[model samples]
Target: MTSVPRRTLNEAVTRFWSLAAPAYDFSALQRWAYRPPQDEVITLLRDHKCRRIVDVACGTGILADRIQRELKTEQVYGVDMSDGMLRQAMARSGDVQWLRAPAEKLPFDDGALDAVVTTSAFHFFDQAAALREFRRVLEPGGIAAVATLAPHQPPLLSRFIDSSRSLAHNPAPDEMRALFTDAGFEVADQHRVRRPLWTRMFTDRITVGVRSA
Candidate 1:
């Protein structure tokens, strides 16, 4: 079977989100399905006391906006590959420096941020390259919190699920921790999180790692 070209796959994802940006915030998936995981990410970042933070693949800037409000800091930034998404994000907040950039290539300087976060979108990233960039842009001892889907049980079934998506890949929980470790971060915490009384439609494994100091 022929594989989809990398560029083609990326462009498709961008186009899809660009079109989805207009009503993304109002989507049930965003309002209901993903709320629990997003909340968990917010709590983790707050607990770490991150003052300077960036949210990657921050569609419509919902999470970034919340972070800015929670931290009461003006150093928050939101980045997404979709221009349409950034436009929507810009309307949401003036404090966050909204930028259009891919996960593998951030606009921040080395050791510039206290925390790097990307929730509900890690499966769409080139995990290795993105993690490396996350580490590169974070100060030593900074936190990297990534919340996303993971492959389910049964080794062969997990492999099948990952292979089913040509443009997206969901790593197993252990594999995600290993990826963070390989990217020069110390695996700090890794677990599945869900809001109480919420449907299990989108439970995500959140992995927190600290850049080696």
Candidate 2:
């Protein structure tokens, strides 16, 4: 697939969330496609005792809010590229540290976070840079969990998703594993979880990796 110019793509994404901000929550687009299996992902973080957690691409701050609610004492940060989305997130979840930032260039100190969670947002990121940045911010032995739509899909539906104008490329299992390894992370786990989407089964996947010391 051909790449869209970086600036243009960023602008388009920003405008998209800006325009969709108000109706983002109510829209099926958010619930049907964008949301991930966050309940289980949050369980993973809690089970691992991750304290400093950041939810990358935390649209409207759902997962971040849930994380804050579940682990009351932990620090939960939400980062997104659109100010509009961050605004909504801040309004909904006042305690979360909502920042306007890109995934590839996070604004955090090196080895500062205990865990990094990306829910349904990895496919939209510049995968290579995102993996490197994730490794950069996480502490040694830090856990990283990425919950996203399945890469392998039914043929026609897969084409529909791939051809979608706003969507990005999805990496197959092997590619995702390789990305984590190349980013200096140890691939610890990979699995699938079923999410209900409009009465249909969305067999999403998750990959957990650890940043080596």
The lDDT values for all models are: 0.85, 0.82
Screening candidate 2 with a backbone cut-off below 3 angstroms (N, C-alpha, C), the clashing residue pairs are: none
Q: Per-residue error at 120 for model 1, in Å?
A: 0.7
Task: Using TM-score, give the best candidate's number.
Answer: 1
lDDT of 2 by residue, 1-213 (tens): 336776676677778888877887885766665554787778888789888999998888988998998788358899999888888899988888999899889999999899999987687778888999999999999998988767666666577456556456778888889999999999999988656745245657889999998
Tens-place lDDT per residue, model 1, 89-160, is 999999898988899999999999999999888987888999999999999999999988766634543453
TM-score of each model, in listed order: 0.90, 0.89
Candidate 2 lDDT for residue 79: 94
Candidate 2 residue-wise lDDT at 165: 62
Question: For model 1, how many clashes?
Answer: 0
Q: Give the TM-score of candidate 1.
A: 0.90
User: How well does candidate 1 match the true structure, expressed as C-alpha RMSD?
Assistant: 3.2
The residue pairs found clashing in candidate 1 are none
